[model samples]
Target: MFVLHIALQGCLRGGEVVFGLTADTGGHIRYLLDLVAASSQDVGVDRIVVATRLFHGAPGPDYAVPEERISDKVELVRLASASPAYRSKEAMHAEVESFARNLVAWIAAQPRPPDLIHAHYADAASVAGLVADRLGIPFVFTAHSLGRVKAAMLGPAAAGCPDLARRIAAEEAALARASLVIASSRDEAEVQYAGYAAYEPGRIRVLPPGSDLARFAAAEPRPQVDAAIDRFLHDPGKPTLLALARPVARKNLGALVRAYGESPELQARANLVLMAGTREDIDALDGDMAGTMREILVLIDCYDLYGRVAYPKTHRPEDVPAIYAHARARGGLFVNPALNEPFGLTLLEASAAGLPLVATDSGGPNDIVETCGNGLLVDPRAPEAIAAACLRILDEPGLYAACVAGGARAAAAYDWDRHAARYHTLLRALLAPEPPLATPRQLLVCDIDNTLVGCAAALGIFRRWRSRQAGLAFGVATGRSFHSAMAILEQQESPRPQVMITSVGSEIHHLDANGVTYTADAAWRARVSADWDRDGVRAALADLDGLVPQGSLEQRGHKLSYFGDAATAQAVRARLVRAGRRANVIHSHGRYLDVLPVAASKGTAVDHVRARYGLPERAVFVAGDSGNDVEMLRAQGHAIIVANYSDDLASQAGLTHSYVARASHARGIIEGVGHFRRMLADAG
Candidate 1:
């Protein structure tokens, strides 16, 4: 099967990647290249294409080339966007529309479309989604680093940045739309993604990326590599504390320097060697990198750590393993004090080089440390904690020996061949076509509480009628959670639905082939997540007078529940408008209020399901009975308002096109289905 991978940030090319050439150029490049190489060996994968932006001027001419063949099975394709100059991830947004259009044109000209498009990072996901939609294919997304998590890490000031907000929106879209989401670690899959409005835990898969550490594991110290670092240190023979990362504030390199400088014991124990990205001139660097370099220099000077510290300004990619080897030869520890790391590739490199670790507790390290048992996790914010962990490892012999043993396991625990096999299986499953009989021709959706379960006798009658209907996929759309909806359906002996849209249309789940389990719909989540600002909504309504927040159970990633009346809902809407937050406010039963993403509602979700199943608008029927159901009830499809509808739903404006059923509860849904069927027959 042919697979296409899209990664738009950084200078990506075949052979000898010059990392840290740009602030955006980092580990993700290493990850994509490694993954492609591994995938090339898989027999299931016949052809592989890596798509990146084509740009010229500065940072080398390799990026200007439109295409390059890496191997017999793997090729690189670069498409030009609006800009021909290199742009950071932050600046890539402006190029998305043009990039997508050009990419679509490029794909149309190809011999055959790729079976699947794997998008890396949010900007590339945005382009992939558009391409997939137009071509009617599937795409998977891998968020190397999520924007919402980064914004939170950056603190309150990040909330006002338009670029961050846009990036977060793109991330939400990726989560909502991708056929699958690949996460590098559990922390990324569970914690980081949980913060997004489109987060669906069932749709996310934790696939730890394999590290190519054979070189590091077999590495030996070289004279040249030693001299590159030793030139800056007064005593090069001391046990080294090594930190290798891009010269950015988020790396927290300054904090590591301060930690070493503040502790006299640490200084006495080891020399600090910092290999922050290759730089020609400190003043010529970008704003963030330049500031970070200046801070590190200042801290070293302030603590009189000149002799004990070595901050190298440059190193080639091949010099990395040797540098790690040099550190291991000196019996040193590798340190990663970044505020947050998506997946620590360097940690695996350090471990393979037989260097024990002192990494930040915030992200990938938690899983890496737990898996390999080779490191101590510390809070990056605490300099004292950072220093203490390093000191503990230095002082204890048994712990150091245990750590060294554990480091041996890193190679086995993460293998590229294993990663490739699993990835191949997932892609094949996504590309598998469904049987004709399994595909639904019609959809019948109903609201649960009042429209389908108000009367026990009617439910029994409805269940009998549903069992005889062929090619009609039955489902329920309700404001309840999945378990709550399922419990009531089972207790009342309601017909098993093929789909369940729960959390007031914020989430969608489909029955598995096993018939007992359900899988969350990742695409739907990506759809409703567009332009959603969950935090902004909360902050906007934090002090709203009339609305009282609901219990913890009622709150959801894409939904916020409250106790409020019509006036309170109106007030909430006005407040959100004033705060420039986009959300959907729904008041039901004169006592409940729910706020959701603007793109989400029972109506839009039903439409999404209908379109997905290849069912025409006229082939779908919906039944509802409350204010929250207003959106879906007024949709273009055949609508039914059960006789028992509350909140004066029958008189709601724009619902005049709906059918006022004579029957109530489940009986009303049956009657409305018959009515629409008869209407269609008459039209034919």
Candidate 2:
């Protein structure tokens, strides 16, 4: 069983498999079903997501299978939406491109997320692998055929395949990042291994296609198949020969037909039955398989070998053993002459059916025939050699019997139970351990003006220009009321005052939920507004007429404040600066210059915000590009200086450590966040 090695100790949540499917016809659909069946035994795979896109004019949800059909062990997460355009040769590519975009978007929005995805081809695999990387999950790829092969075979049609190029690239990346690559045969590994980067030769193990030996072993001998065999017998009863596959040209069926036509002794004694799957479209014949099959049929008709050849309707793979048994009972040969096979799985099925075999001397077939010690191999293109091989097997009974015995013994290697076990081991190795999550208990106290957005005060230019800004301004973390301190703040410019000291140092109100929950600490703030003296420093220029006067004093929550009027406020501020008693002013709306309680700062509020969000204190950092942000800069765990930072602020604080990045504004923020994230990773 693929065990969960490192999981949230408290969160024993379920997981899903997003398996990509592009086609349902031919071996593609059966191959998917076989994998799902084998993976069901693993403990960690709780669901299977059939990641699909509609194609061939089929309506989907039509492409998606329901959760119930995938057994009780798997729930299906169908990620589908608006599809891309197709059919028009020039526009098929544009359509697929649109589909690829929608497909990628849908995959990213998955709610629970998949634990891993099994991509059937390089195209689907690359997209799935990219999402998995972003979300920290595993992605595996199974390219049934190499990209070079598909391109050569499909020609112009291959360019329209959306994920084709990305698939090739992503497969190589997934190889480096995946826990393991399930190579169906050593031959598949050898052919593809050199194409991938840093591909460990040992990691590519020889795990052939899965098989159900017991199921095939139990198939009952059928009379329907039996009767078809009887009519083909000649004066000297010859052995029967059956070949099953999609009649695609790559299956090399025309050569088999010609070979059967050329061998008179084998032809006289036996009949050759070739069954390629049926298709709904004569137009679909323009595709590779369709065109290939048509070429073979043309050759078959050209030879005028009609009496000895037979074509059967498509049968399910599970029922193929019955065909094998009926042919073998009459001493027939099960032949497979594929040109470039990837683990001749059907041959393994033939072995389970207890049939004698004749295969070609190429690719995966060589491994099967050589391992099983079954029948002879002849050149597929040469009819004389093919006919000669078939005759030799039939004429000598001992040779045919040896092939049957060898097939039965060779079938032992591909048991599903063992395949599942190996799969489990590979999965567990990849996820053996993970970091424990930290508790959510933190806050972020922050200064609003230059600290948040680069500004002289909280409110920006529009309010400043209207002469509606305050004076004796504050630029700190407190949410203190503007009304209490507006008169004093607006004294600097010709602005009439209505706001307060409530922005930075004192107020804490949710404008949306609870309005004005906290008040400005007015009395304490006033002490810092004037001169330093023995009598606790009364506003030294308080009654000075040349200086700015307090503005209209409104009720700020519960506190009363003395705000300077326009003239008195301006006079008071200028006179104080002359007296060497400058108020720690925060020039707010360019019109108002406000003063703040020296003790309060932007860094003070950062702690509050950080704690509310359950973030760690040590994890907090602050950055600002102004002299007004000195306190917060000192308060932060890490401080950064942008290229546009206040020269005074940068000089006081030496942040020129190598960790300091050479960026400004938005770019600086981006680089800073990335640097912090990398630090966390390295610490982990």
Best by TM-score: 1
Per-candidate clashes, comma-separated: 3, 79
Q: What lDDT score goes with residue 522 in model 2?
A: 42
Model 2: per-residue Cα lDDT over 442-541, one tens digit each: 1222233333334324223323433321211112232333322221222212122111223443333211111111222344344333342312113555
Query: Residues 1-684, candidate 1, lDDT per residue (tens digit)?
Result: 999999999889988888888888889999998999999998878999999999999787999999999999999999999999999888899999999999899889989989899999999999999998799768899999989877987899897889999999999999999878888776777678889998876566667788887988999988998998898888899999999999998899999998998999999999999999989998877548999999999999999998889888899988989999989989999999999898899999999899999999877887789889998999999999999999999899899988888889999877787788767866776676332236888899999999999899999899899888999999899998665576457546687678899888999988766343367888998988889888889988999998999855467889999999899999999999999999998899999999999988899899999988988999999999999899998885699999999999998899998998999999999999999999999999
- Candidate 1 colliding pairs: 176-525, 176-526, 177-526
Once superposed on the true structure, which residue ranges of model 2 sit more than 4 Å away at CA? 1-24, 54-68, 81-112, 149-179, 195-203, 225-237, 280-286, 316-318, 378-382, 433-684
Q: What TM-score against the true fold does each predicted structure earn?
A: 0.67, 0.53
> CA lDDT of 333 in candidate 1?
94
Go through the candidates in order and give the C-alpha RMSD of each one to the true structure. Answer: 13.5, 29.7
What's model 2's TM-score?
0.53
Cα-based lDDT for every prediction: 0.88, 0.50
Ten contiguous residues minimizing lDDT sum, candidate 1: 429-438
